[model samples]
Target: MLSDHDFLRYSRQIMLPLCGELGIKTLAKARVVVIGAGGLATVVAPYLVGAGVGYLRLCDDDIVSVSNLPRQWLYSPAHIGQQKVRVMAAQLKALQPAAQVEAIPEYADNSNLCRLMSGADLVLDCSDNMTTRQLVNAYAMDAGVALVSAAAIGLHAQAAAFQPSLCGPHGNHGCYRCLYPIDSQRAGNCQSEGVLGPMVGMAGCYQAALALRILLGDPNVPWSQLWRLDSTLGEHQLLRIQPDPSCSVCGHVSHSNASSDDSSIPNSGV
Candidate 1:
């Protein structure tokens, strides 16, 4: 049911064997919620919009700052001091007026996370902080929505997809908490450790690819795969992760409680 304009707009993507008319239709109908309008979002939003995602909800409370210019490519010098969501939403609309773009000009906290994520087909965590990533993961798991979590610092980046269903009938695929372990410590944030702009873009692109695969119902791509790219070492690693028996989030016992109290997970200070 693609319109003439849509057919023309997505011709190149549609021509690909992995993404034909069916994939384009899936992309057009997908509703995605992206948390963070910073470095990763710069690449993700535009690609999603261009690919014709029906609805895109953007959440970011920060404003465009001069310091963010190096990594956040969506903003221009003129957009300095403008609200991140507002400016990014405007730019996305300009790129694809057909896509529905909602700008939540506030930080996504426990109070508003449910509202922001309600009815979303998928969620993308592009935020720099580990706390927000955990929050988003918890909420997505609770809502039974797929989540694509990604992070990049310096020349290193990691991307993973979490689908609750893959946790198996007994809740198998480990949750974010299982992967990081509540007691584990994180390094530092990109700001503190310094991140290369292209590295962030590379991670974001990987996230987008996985998100598209999920939307397209590609059975070959599992929901528990982790892709790591280290430009520093010129290495790309793909790890197959399984659910942990004692995971605090998606474990058999945790599934019954649906608790958000991950206080047991130690903060990595990232």
Candidate 2:
């Protein structure tokens, strides 16, 4: 049960038809793990906390650099040499003192992946590189957890929500590997390219939206759809997607409808 303060603080979110009191309470019990504390996690964490996600594990093993300040909104000159997760952890506490936010200053490699993701309700891949995305995808597949993956470089951004248990017939609803099978072929990253600050913020917010919808069990959401945003050109596109039948990560997935228990909102076509 939410205290009066919690209800008052999140009244707006609670008022939404999709996320009413029940949804808000569901969010309050949700546990989310975010990979990367750079541009995306900085904003994503705050949104999740603000909306009352009960617990959050923020994972990153990087340090704050002068170059990262332009996009990472949580840090300043004083935090230049500090650990990314630690600094963000403090900021998240300040945002919602009651929320439990842990700064796990470790990279999400195969060695620590399971530990990092254990008991997580949702995982967000806000990572900058393809390797991390692939690793996260494989882990999410094995754990049978939903994943919201997004990446932004320059003016282009791509995001998707992968719900393995919610797969559709005709081989629909694939993981990240379904779209980009080979890491060698999936090109472009922030390191090799320039990106606008709003671009990361934009993509991160979209990722947060998808995670919240899943947490709330919003029945109308079109799970496993690829959303592309072009901030430079002011264009956006949403394409329905499915897990690759031969995907090494989710190849064994069965071609059956999701359990009837899953919630869905009408595809608003927004």
Write down the lDDT of every candidate, Cα atoms only.
Answer: 0.81, 0.81
lDDT per residue, candidate 1, 136-155, as tens digits?
77777767789999889988
Candidate 1 collision pairs: 154-195, 167-172, 167-173, 174-243, 182-265, 182-266, 186-268
Q: lDDT by residue for model 2 over 1-270, one digit each (tens)?
A: 778987898899988999888887888789999999999998899999989898999999999999998999899989999999999999999998988999999998767777888889999998888777887877776677789998899999889998867643344577777778765434588878889888898899999998898899988766778899987789999987765666665565442212221111111111
Q: Candidate 2: worst 10 consecutive residues by lDDT?
A: 261-270
Q: In every candidate, how many clashes are there?
A: 7, 11
lDDT of 1: 0.81
RMSD of 1: 3.9
Best by TM-score: 1
Task: Please report the TM-score between candidate 2 and the true structure.
Answer: 0.89
Give all TM-scores, in the order shown: 0.91, 0.89
